[model samples]
Target: DAGITQSPRYKITETGRQVTLMCHQTWSHSYMFWYRQDLGHGLRLIYYSAAADITDKGEVPDGYVVSRSKTENFPLTLESATRSQTSVYFCASGAGSLTDTQYFGPGTRLTVL
Candidate 1:
């Protein structure tokens, strides 16, 4: 009730299907980010929003889409999920200050078959 939360904690879908992962934060942080964690690799940023209505692509942006029309919600969509998209997705929020800490959601594990 006081932190970030992600929906569909686990999912299994076929290739080419569209998948949307939801993230909501209770702190109303100004900065939100989407990251992907694959086996044997660190988390890779897929997208980020500095504030509501302002978003930017990160390290890996292809095949993914994001929107932030509200400050507390950031939704990540896989336009066409592929096997390569199988991984754990994380949603995080920060206070937008240098010293502020980033809070992360539990994470959503997506498997594309």
Candidate 2:
């Protein structure tokens, strides 16, 4: 695929369990990001990686972990899923340029019970 893609477009899980969302891109972009979209919060960045093995936390990083082991894959893991984490998760990638626009995947809607 030339663009990005996400897995488990819809997910349901019990609270306190771990869930991992997958993100893959073919463009080999240098920057990858994970964000969660909620009704009031809009888009909040959870984590991002500039390149392989270089990851950083974003605005809402608590209870979430991200790893970029390869240039084209960035996975986000929720260590202990909670009801508050229920939202739409989106994975995006972009070039290093500030002018570059991020390309978003379809998104994953997760619900925690």
Candidate 3:
């Protein structure tokens, strides 16, 4: 992926409610992923997909859900927002392998209250 961007750069939501973060890429990368940036955890992968409809869970995917209905769109949803889930979320895409370069989208700042 060469270009990526996220929508609703900042969001505030109440606990137990659902929130979805949108990510779009201009390039058609084979792999896309969602990661959360927290104070202590640094960057933790929430979920990833190799292709459309082929998804997999990552390090911290418990409270999150992801779907890639198209090559350029990957949306991450928080099933039930919680304070612990408050963090900056980033979406990234890569060519195919781990060694390939990846491009990250502008992060979404989510605050759960």
Q: Which scores better on TM-score, 2 or 3?
A: 2
Task: Give the count of colliding residue pairs in each prediction.
Answer: 0, 0, 0
After superposition, candidate 3 runs with Cα above 4 Å error: none
Top candidate by TM-score: 2
Residue 55 lDDT in candidate 3:
93
Candidate 2 lDDT over 51-81, as tens digits, reads 9999988999999988888999999999999
Q: Against the correct fold, how does model 1 do in TM-score?
A: 0.95
Q: Which pairs in model 3 have colliding backbones?
A: none
- Cα lDDT computed for each candidate against the true fold: 0.94, 0.93, 0.91
Q: TM per model?
A: 0.95, 0.96, 0.94
- Between 1 and 3, whose TM-score is larger? 1
lDDT of 1 at 11: 96
Residue range 1-25, candidate 3, lDDT tens digits = 4589999899999999999999999
Stretches of candidate 1 above 4 Å error? 98-100
Q: What is the C-alpha RMSD of each candidate to the true structure, in Å?
A: 1.3, 1.1, 1.7
Query: For model 3, what is the error of residue 12's alpha carbon versus the real structure, in angstroms, after optimal superposition?
Result: 0.3
